[model samples]
Target: MKIVLIITDYGSFNNFLSDLAIRLKEDGHEVSVITSETRVINIQDKFDYLAAGIKFFYVDFPRGFNPFAHYRSSKKIQKILDSIVPNIVHIHFTTGIFTTLFAGRVKYRTLGTFHGLGFPVLSGLKKQVFGAVEKFCFGRLDKIYVLNEVDYKAVKALGYKNVEKYETLGLGCDLSVFNPDNFSETWKASLREELDIGVNDFVFAYTGRFVNFKGYDKVIRSFLKLYSKNSKVKLLLIGGNDPIHPTGLTENETILMNNCEGIIHIGFTKDVASYLSITDVFVFPSVKEGMPVCVIEALAMGVPVITADSRGCNEIVQNDYNGYVVDVTDDNWSGVYEKMEQLIINKDYINQFKSNIQQDRNDYDRNRYVICEKSRYEQYSSIEK
Candidate 1:
C-alpha cells in the first residue's frame, strides 16, 4: 500500500518523519512526506541527505491567514493527490488551517494524527480559522488517530464517534539506535567524559522546546527541590531556547540554573537519541500534548519517562510502574518533572523504577504502529464488496 504522510509539525531531518518513512518501508508500504518548510537555518544539508531516499514535497507555508495562501497550498496538494491518489492520507501535523488543502482529497481514508497542542503562537481569532478547517477536514475522514486519552475524550465530546486514539499507534522510535547492544565502550566513555558526567552520577534529561506549556519550569523547580536535599543528581535541558514564551528558557532558564545545582544546558542538536542512550531518566511535564514524539522516543530507547499527568504523556507511562506522573500545574510547578526526573536516576529508587521493560516494550514499537496504520489504509483502499 502507498501512504502519504503530511507533516506540518516539524522540519529538517526530523526523527518522527524519518522513522515513519523508514519503518513504513520496512513494513512493505510506499511512504511519502509533505511539509511546509524546514524552518531552521543551515539544516538544509541534513534535509537534502534525508530526502534522497524518501519521497518529499514542500510547500511555502503562508504566514498570515491569507486567503491566497490557502488557495495556493490547497491547489498544490490537490495536484499531488490527483497524480498519486494515495491509499491513505495521514496527516502528522496541520500548519494553520491552510493544511485542509488535501485533507479529504482521497476517496479512501484520511487519518489525521494530532501531534501536539496547538503551536504556541496560535490563539483567539487565529484559532478560529484552525477550528473551521479541522471540523471540515475531520468530518471528511474515515478515522481520526488521537494520540492520548485526553484528545480521545475531547474529540468524542466534540461530537466525533468514529475516533480511536491508538496513542500506541503514534510515532515511536528506532529502538536499535537506543539499544544497549549498539553502544561501544569507547563511544560511551567519550560521551560520558564530554558531558562531564560521571559513570555513577544519575543523568536527568528533559527534551522539548523550552516553552511554557512544555512544563520545563517544573523540571527546573523540581530539580532545585531535589538538589537542595541531595546534590547527587545531574540535569540536562535539551531543545531550542526560545525566550518569547511565558515560560521560555531565556528568562526563566537563567533563574532556574542559578537557583539549581548539578544542571547542564545543551541546546538544539540532532544527537537526541545519543543523549537518550546515556540518560537514566527522561522528564517531560507538559501541560498539554496531542501525543509527544519526544516522550515516545525516550520510551523506545528503553529509558523510563516522567511526564505531566496530562492526556498524551499518561498514555505512554504507567504510574509508579514504568515511571511517575503527578500534575504540578496546581502549585509548586517549578520542581515537577525535575522532582520525578531524579527518581529514575537514583539506582536505589528500586521498585519505583522498572529497570527492564522486556516484553512490555513491544506495545510501543514503531514498526507495530506503522503496520496498524498501513493495514487501515489497505482495508480502506480496497473496494468494499
Candidate 2:
C-alpha cells in the first residue's frame, strides 16, 4: 500500500509521526510525507526518513487563517494527491486536515487525526466559525482518529455521515527514550550543574511553543510569583516561539521569558528527555491540546505534571493522583499558583505523584500506539475504495 501522510510542519512530523512513518515503511508499505518547511524542521529527521526509504513533499501550509493561503495550499495538495495517487491519505493537525479537505474531490480515502479542537477552547464568533469549518471538513473524511475523548466526542456529536470511524487513540510517547531509569543521578547532577540548576532546586518545566493559547505567559507569571516567595524553584522552558502561528507570545512575555532570573529558556532542542530527566515537576498550562506528547513523555519519565483542566490535559492527569489539574477557565490561574506552591513546599506530595506515574506509565508507551496505527493503516489499505 502506498500511504501519504500530511501535516502542517516538519517539526511536528519529526516529533510525533516520524516513528509511525518508519514503522509503516518497515511493515512493507510505500510511505511518503507532505509537510510545510519551517525553522523547526530538524535536518536529522529529514535525513532519517530519507534513509528509511520514505519520500518527502513540501507544501505551503501556513498555520494562521488566510483564505487565499488555504486555497493555494489546497491546490498544491491536490496536485500532490494527483501525482501520488496514494491508497490512504492520513492527514494530521487541524490546519493540514482543513487545507487538504478543502482541496475538493480526490480519489483516495482520507483519514484525519485531530490533535485537538480549537473551537472547544475558543469563544463566541471564533468558536462558531471554527465549528462550522470543522463540520464541513469532517463530513468529507473517510475515517477520523481523535487523540482525546474530548475530540472524539466533539466529532461524534457532529454526526458526519462520511466519517466511517473515529476513535480516541492518544498520541503516545517513546517510553524507552523518556524512561527515568535511562538517566543516572550522576548524569542528572552533571546536566544540572551545566545549566546552573542547583541540586536542591525544585524544577518546574514546560515544553511547547511559547504562544498565547499555550498559556506560557500565565506559566511565566506564576513562576515569577513563586520565585519571589521561594527562591529555590526554577522554571525550564524547552520550546521556541511559533513564528507561523498567530498566537505567538507578547513582547513583554517574550522579554520575561528571556530575561527572568531562575527561568531558563533553552529555546528548541530535540533532547527534551534529557531536560525531563532532571525535572521535578512538568507544568503545562495550555488552553487546548489533542493528547499532548510532552505530558505523556513527562509521565513516562516518572515526572508528575501540573496542567490545565482543558480537554486533552484533564483526561491525561488524574487530579491529586498523577498531578494537579488546575481550572484555568475565564483566565482564572489562581489554582495553577496554588498547585505549584503545594508541590514546591511538600516533597511527600511530589513523591506520591511520582509513585502513581511509575505504575501507570506503560499506558502511554509508543510501541502500542505504533502497532495500533500500523494495524489501522493495513486494515484501511486492504479495503477496496
Candidate 3:
C-alpha cells in the first residue's frame, strides 16, 4: 500500500512525519509526505526531513487565511495532490492547507489524525462548525484518528463517525537517542558541571515551547513560592524562547520570558535526552495537551512526572500510580508545589520513577498503533480487493 501524510507544519527537523514515514516503510509500504513549509519554524528543522525512503511534496498552505493567499496557496497544494495520486491520504493538524479536503474528491481513502490543541473548550470547533464544508473537506474518509480519548470524543460529537481511537505508543520518546544506557552516570554528571549546577542541587526540568497555554508562567509562579522559602530547587526551561519574529515577540510571551524567575533558558538544544537524563525531576504544567511527547520521554528516561490534570495526560499517568496529575488551573498550583516538594525531599520517590519506567516502555511504540493507521487507510481506499 502507498501512504501519503499531510501536515501543516514541515521543515528540516520535525519528527512527527519523519518518525511515521520510517515506521511505514520499515513495514514495507511506500510513503510520501505533503508538508506546509515553515520558514521561521525551527522546532523540527535540525533533522533530516527525508531520512526515510519517503518523498515529500511542499505546498505553502495559507496557515492563516487571507482571500488572495488562500486562492494561490491552496491551488499549489491541489496541483501536487493531483500528481501524486496517493492511494491513502493521512492528514495531520489541518491548520494551513485544504488539500486533504480537496483530495476527498477522489476515490482514494483519506484519514485525519488529531494531535489536539490544548484548550478546555475543544478548540476544534472553529473548523468544524461548517458541517457541509467539513464534510466536503473530509471527502469520504475511511477513518479519522485521535491520539487521546478526548480527541476521539470531540470528533465524534461533531457527528463524525467512522473514527478510530488508538492507544499511545508509550514509545513517543526516541528510544534510539533517548536510551537510558546511552549516557553513563558520569556523562550526566558532566552536564551538571557544564551548567555550573552543584551535584546535590535539586534540578527540575520543564521542556516544550514556552507558550501561555503550555503553563510555563504558572510553573514560574509556583517556583517563586518555592524560592521565597529558599528551597534549593533550580529549573531548566528547554525551548523557553522562539525568535521574536522577523517582526517581534508577542508582548505577552516576551514579558513572561523576561520575568521568569530562577529559570535558565537553554534556548534550543539538540541534546535533549542527555539533559533529560541528568535532571532530577520532570515537571509538566500544561493547561491543555494531546499526549505530550515530553512527558513520555521523561518517563522512558525514568524521571518522575508532575502534569496538570487534563485528559490526554490522564491517559498517560494514572495519577499517583505512575505520576501526579492535578486539575490544570492557576489556583491549584500550591498543591502542585507540594507534590514536587515531597519528591524533592525524598530520594526513594525519585528512585521509583526511574526503576519502573522500563516496565512500561514497550507499551507505546508507534509501529503497533500506527500500523492500524495504514490498515484503515488501505481498507477504505480499496473496494472488494
Query: In candidate 1, what are the lDDT values of residues 47-109, reduced to their tens digit?
Result: 443544567787665555577777778678767766777777777554532355543355545
Can you rank all candidates by lDDT, best first? 2, 1, 3
Q: At residue 337, what lDDT does model 3 achieve?
A: 85
Compute each candidate's TM-score over C-alphas: 0.80, 0.94, 0.83
Model 1 regions more than 4 Å off: 9-13, 23-30, 39-53, 62-67, 96-98, 102-109, 116-133, 167-169, 184-187, 224-231, 242-246, 249-261, 334-338, 341-346, 350-352
Q: Please write out the lDDT profile of model 2 over residues 43-120, one tens digit for every residue.
A: 245337767999989998866678888888898888988899899999997788898877585678888887887775
Report the C-alpha lDDT of model 3 over 1-385, residue by residue, as the tens digit. Answer: 7777778757421655566677678788877777766633345344454665678777766544455675665566657766777677677763532444543244455566656533323447654443333444444556666678876776677676876676554226566676778888798788888887777778788887766566666666666666667546678877644343121235664565457555566755557777788777888877566677778877777777888887677778766666777775645567578877788778786677666666887665545555665566657667531
Task: At residue 76, give the lDDT of candidate 1.
Answer: 81
Mind sharing the TM-score for model 3? 0.83
**Best candidate per lDDT, number?**
2
Residue-pair clashes per prediction, in order, are 6, 1, 8
Best by TM-score: 2
Selected candidate, larger TM-score, 2 vs 3: 2
Off by over 4 Å in 3: 11-13, 26-29, 39-53, 65-68, 96-99, 102-107, 117-120, 123-140, 169-171, 242-261, 330-332, 377-381
* lDDT, residue 1, model 3: 76
Off by over 4 Å in 2: 39-47, 161-169, 244-257
